[model samples]
Target: MPAGASTGLPLETDRLLLRPWRVSEAAIQRELWTERDPRVPARRRIDADGRPTVADFEEAISAAAVPSSTGLLAVELKADAAVVGYCGLVEGGPETEGEPELAYELLRRFWGLGYATEASWAVIDWARSSGHRRLWATVWAWNVESLRVLAKLGFAEVRSEQHPVHGTNRVTMKRL
Candidate 1:
């Protein structure tokens, strides 16, 4: 298989390995979509028609170029080698120029085990080494778990937007 990226890839923590997505892991992506929180935007969840099916991910994995410094990395357990989730950086839009957005998602079965924080720490180090001066993360205020994780990671709330029904979306920033 191709290496995850040109650099900072296959990052290792004491219990996990941050690597590239594999074509065989399409089902895992689909699972994550299906398991999304109900409060998550509909467009982000698996639809009634099962849009963004495994085939879509297969095509994506097949066509994707080698990841750049800011690409997502698969979070996997080192003991049993099961992929738990993903964590990394993505473009945050024109306003965020040099500050990429940090993102992560883990299977429900793996929650509350410190994996998110651990994985995020690895990504943060990678981001800093990649020369990023800052990073941003957006989380729903209702997701107290994610909020706690962000807090533990040293992100400070910079802004918030209240949704009509889903509550608030908090935007946070962290200096790398």
Candidate 2:
């Protein structure tokens, strides 16, 4: 594992390199936004043509450069350094009070290969060592795979709420 330039902390897993977002990865980021599951909220997913707008890529690049302390970072494949998707923290969740949220996403083809679990476990460890009292994640109930990953990471369901897109959203938390 190598220390991240932005956070001064390592974020590596067995097969993934959790690195900072680079401007050159905009195309892949756009593709990620375009080809994501259709069940996601409209504002986050690409439009009907299944193509992300130019602004989407720009926004992604901008968001990625947010100092790494509070934005999603690129999850690159250690085998070939391909931009598979993203995994890191963000600032919003049901409970705010200084708790950063855990988030991860893989390109559809990359799912079902244990990447999410590996990356999430690393994140939980990082958060715990970084002095966070607790780490949290929000998952749609219908996303059973993600729910299972959260459970495997030692996160317990703290609350549930009706979602506008998905039927329900589960807010899970892990004490660090």
Candidate 3:
């Protein structure tokens, strides 16, 4: 289990490599925006104004912090080196102030192949190495696939919040 370059070394799994985002790959982010599930917030998807254009992602990629224990890493296939998505830890607001929250997304084409689970496992290992004892993740109720992945990773749902547009958000936690 190696950390990414920005943080130290790329986190590698049997078939995936979790690494930092590159400016040249900003277009991939835009593609993800287009492929987002309709249940995803409009702000996260492409809006009428295209709020998160390639330029926007490029700027973010260039300015990303060298995270010590949290950051999104690009998920690339070890066999072909194609970036399939991203997965990592992020601040989960006040409810999970101390414990970083797990988050992951994959291109629709790559869904159902266990990439999300595999990438998440690496991130979880990284968190444990960073001295974290617990981790959290939130998933929309309609996202059965994500719920299954979390469950396979030992995350138990602790609570749910109602969202005006996305229905219910299930908050899950796992102890390292």
Candidate number with greatest TM-score = 3
**Per-residue lDDT of model 3, residues 1-176, tens digit only:** 24553354489999999998899999998898898888898877999987789999999999997666789999999999999999999977876755799999999999999999999999999998887899999889999999999999999989999989889999899999
In model 1, the Cα lDDT at residue 113 comes to 98
The local lDDT score (0 to 100) that residue 17 gets in candidate 3 is 94
Worst 10 residues of 2 by lDDT: 1-10
**Candidate 1: stretches off by over 4 Å:** 1-6, 94-98
**Per-residue C-alpha lDDT of model 2 across residues 67-173, encoded as one tens digit per residue:** 34555778888999998888877776446455888899888899899998888777776666566777789888888988988888888998888977568888888
Please give the clash total of every predicted structure, in order: 0, 0, 2
- Give the clashing residue pairs of candidate 3, or none: 3-9, 4-9
lDDT of 1 at 167: 85
Candidate 2 residue pairs in backbone clash: none
- lDDT per residue as tens, model 1, 75-163: 99999999988888888974455568999999999999999999999999988887788999988998999999999999999888788
For candidate 1, give the lDDT of residue 99: 67
**What TM-score should be assigned to candidate 3?**
0.93
The C-alpha local distance difference test score for the whole of candidate 2 amounts to 0.77
**Runs in model 2 lying further than 4 Å from the true structure:** 1-6, 48-55, 62-68, 96-98
Q: Give stretches of model 3 more than 4 Å off.
A: 1-8
Cα deviation at 75, candidate 1, in Å, is 0.5
